[model samples]
Target: MLRFAPSPTGDMHIGNLRAAIFNYIIAKQKGEKFLIRIEDTDFSRNIEGKDTEILSILNLFGLLWDELVYQSHNFERHRNFADYLIKHDKAFYCYCTKEFLEKKKQEALDLRIPFRYDDAWAEIQKKDNPKPVVRLRGSFEPISFYDEIKGRLEFYPNELDSFVILREDGIPTYNFACACDDMIYDISFIVRGEDHVSNTPKQILIQKSLDYQKQLGYAHLPIILGESGKKMSKRDSASSVSWLLGQGFLPQAIINYLIGMGNHTPVEIFTLKDALEWFDIANIAKSPVKFDLKRLRYVNREHLKRLNESEFSLLLQTQDITIGALGKLYLEEASTLNEIREKLGLIFSPKDIDVTYEGESFKEECLKLFEVLWGMSMQGESFIEYESFKNEAMKRSALKGKKFFKPLRILLTGESHGVDLNELYPYLRFYFKDILRIKGEK
Candidate 1:
């Protein structure tokens, strides 16, 4: 069984989505039970409707979990395990306040000693009338677990802390709650981000203490870094899945792009269907993957290209884009919604070009070329033959210079470079006709 545990602290970022997707793929491929567990342990940071929004987005990408569980609702289960650990001598109470711990840490630092919770742990063990926060009594030997992907990871006793399993607020910390949930849910595999590597040993310790029967497999996926090789932030790009969707990214494209990030697969372009068939946790890369905007755009364009005309039209309707204006201009050229979207910047208002090049010395010459091509049909004209027309226009108008084509290119496609003018002409013609018909109505 696989479970996706997402904390409802904020919007579902790409990192979070990747984890969910990886788990979803594994569960689907193996024909195992998959579930969603909301780890809202930090109540203060939990955002309302975040879980619902996450579920909705997951559904949009076809990442559905078989069952849903809320950590908040299982408070008693976590509390029971914490009490059991205390009774079994696996955990002890620590009453030291933050000030006392800070002072101890500073004194240790001043003396050039190992500054850790050593003093705090000793004090809590001996102190009378301890306010009592439970801590795991870690083994003094190195703990090791074989990460399915990273492989043969070991953590020394000194490196592991007597982490708090139950907070002073009586709420179980993430480590305790997660271990309990995984055990109860029979989650055979744990797939999450690489940031949780240090926490894995601690969770394993808790799992061992609880006598969990199943040996859980772990797959820690690499981080998605920004162009600067730093962790991607909300400031760096669209942080939320909803934000990306709002920005016109298709959910399947986002899913496909994410799967490519850290996972090693021969399949370059993946659909949601492809992921379900080929997802293997062992294939996930150990190295971090950088978020490349150019690569993402490429994936999006591929998805755009794959959409049939009907699907593309449905995409426009879903986005509330009225294609009436676009339809008139590119009648046959605008074969897909992607073409329409790509052509939007090219489909300009007459006033825009009217302002910039209207009275210029070469304006009349440009307009004549534009008008001739505007009403031109490809019915009898082959794309190869249209190239001949472009060459002839250049020769006849003596406007073969860069300035002439540069503005013309922009006027035709709103981009300086794209598919050749001959192939692009039909779409541009459609766009102009749409604009002209709209203007005629007024």
Candidate 2:
């Protein structure tokens, strides 16, 4: 079994999405159940509907889970496990006030030592105290676990000190909630960023004290670094999955870039369906990878080329198949839907012919060329050879050279200079009526 327990906090970060993908792929490979556990117990911080947004994004990327659950729904079960530890003398309540604990923590800093819980606090009974927080009676012994990607890992006893499990208000801390739920769900393996490595030993302690015997699997990949070599922030480009999708980055491209990080693959570019065959955690790079937004654009371009005409149309948000087909012509110069839309807008948008655009020197010729084309334009929506049409228009207008091509070029492609007319016209030919005559015109 595998689970992705994300909080409904803001938009889903790129890191969490990568974690979810790794877990889903592994589960699918092993024919095991994959589950989504929305860790929404921290009601104070959770953003409403962000959970739905997360699932929808996962679906957009084709990551279908075998089961789904909310961590808050298991609140009673979490409390019960905490109680069991208390009854077994594995944990006890501490009446230390927030100010008091802060003083002790600061004192540790003064002494230049790590803050470990003062055992004396538990002995002090305060009648004024509200519901006290529960703390584990941690042992002074080394704990270790094997990580699938990182290999053998261990934590020393001095580093693993007694910590709070549940707050005075009956709210479980992250380590407590996550550990309890992992056991409750009978999860077989865990895959998350390397930042969570320290928390692994603490979670292991929770299960050991409760006599839960399952040895959980773990794979902690190196955390992604921003260009500044710091952890990702909102300032970073790839920080928000929602923002990336909104910017017209293909989900397949994002998946391709992420999967290829620190892992060997059969190909540089592949669909999610193709990844299922060659993905292996053992091949993943154990080093931190830099998230490059530029590389995503390059990958996006490759995916754009793979798209058929219908997909091109959908990418541009158009029902007109001609507009969609024309979008493909701009693919060589565009990597995103937004970019292609700009190109389509340049072409399909009714060209406003200003005879004076070329100055009075050629204004008369421009006017004559426009009249000739408009008169012969709006033909049957069938294809027309560009040379024949342009040549005849030039003959009728009695204009050639600079006078001929410039006016015709502006009329066809909204640009006075660009790819030759022969290359653009065939794909754009269907939209002649749309381009030549303004709307509400004869």
Candidate 3:
């Protein structure tokens, strides 16, 4: 079985969705069970309805999990395992207070020694009164594991501390709980973000102590970073799935863009079916995938172009627009929705578009072009025939240059560049006739 354990902390970001999608594809391809585990162990960080939002977004991308599990509900099971580890001498209780550990760390730095909790301190606590925070016992030698993507990795035991397994609050830390859950659920493959690579050895240690080593395989997917080379945050406008959805990006387009990131492939666009067929853990790139908004836009545009007319119409309807109205204006002369979408931006709400042009002559030409387009509409002829008339008017005005195209563009679409005039005019004829009429009056 495969599992995607997402923390219910905030909105589902693109990186989180990519992880879930990859796990979903692997499960479907292998005919294995895929489960959703809500890791809400940290009650302080949990947000209301975060799980619902996560589930909703996953459903939007057609990624469904077979079972839903909550880590909080498994507290007793984790505690039982932690007790068993202590009984077997695989873990020990430490009563080291925060101030003691901080001072010890500072002393080690002063001596230029490694700044990890020493087991010697564990002995001192054992002699003194111990508050009993469980800690996993580490070997004197190195611990290593074969990561599916990163290959063989080794970590020295001395380099790591006798890290807490069960915290002072009696709650299992992430490593202990995650290992216990994976074992109990019989999760055969563990696929998660590469940031958890360091935690693998510790988890592996717990699994080994519990004798469940052969039952699990580990694969760490690379991180998705922003163009600035930092982990993407909610503040980054393009980071969240909901943000992209609100911006009219199709879920499949986002999935396709994610699949292409980090992986070496010529496939710039993919459907969910295509992804399931092609997703291979071995082929996943080890390097970080840079998130580029421009690349995403291009990929989304390609996917949008491939949608059938009915599908395209449904997408528009979701935003409260009608296909019949769209067709009456844009497709009266064009044959496909792809063409309509290409020109549909002209009818988008002003706040939705980013227009950039600043010159008197450019503004004048745009206004003049709007006047001509307006003239054609008032004449009661279809806007489809306005292109030729526009050309003649441009020639007569001796403004038939790039300057002439600008103001017309601004007037038609409220933008300086997008959806050529020829295709844009018809769409405006249907959706934004009133807006154009208002522009004409000005």
Best by lDDT: 2
* TM agreement with the true structure for every prediction: 0.80, 0.92, 0.81
Candidate 3: C-alpha RMSD after superposition: 5.1
Error of 3 at 63 (Å): 1.2
Better of 2 and 3 by lDDT: 2
Query: Candidate 2 residues 1-442, lDDT tens each?
Result: 9988888988888989899999999898888999999989888999989999999999999989888999888878889999999999999999888888899899999999989886678756567586789998785788999998889998988887788999989988899999998998889999998989999999999999999899999999888888788888877757899999988899999998888877789988998878888788878888888888878889998998898888777767777777777777777677888887776676766655643453534445656776777677644423378888777887889988888888787777765666677878887666676777432346
- Pick by lDDT: 1 or 2, better one: 2
Q: Output the TM-score of candidate 3.
A: 0.81
- Rank by TM-score, descending? 2, 3, 1
lDDT of 1 by residue, 291-375 (tens): 8866776777677666655565567674322343333234344433445565653455442333344334344544655555544
Candidate 1 CA-lDDT value: 0.73
Q: Which prediction has more favorable TM-score, 2 or 3?
A: 2
* CA deviation > 4 Å runs, candidate 1: 119-130, 318-342, 345-350, 357-433, 437-442
TM-score of 1: 0.80
* Poorest stretch of ten by lDDT in candidate 2: 354-363
Q: Can you write out model 3's per-residue Cα lDDT over 35-103, one digit (the tens) per residue? A: 999999999999999989888888888887899999999999999998898899888888777777899
| Weakest ten-residue segment in model 1 by summed lDDT | 433-442
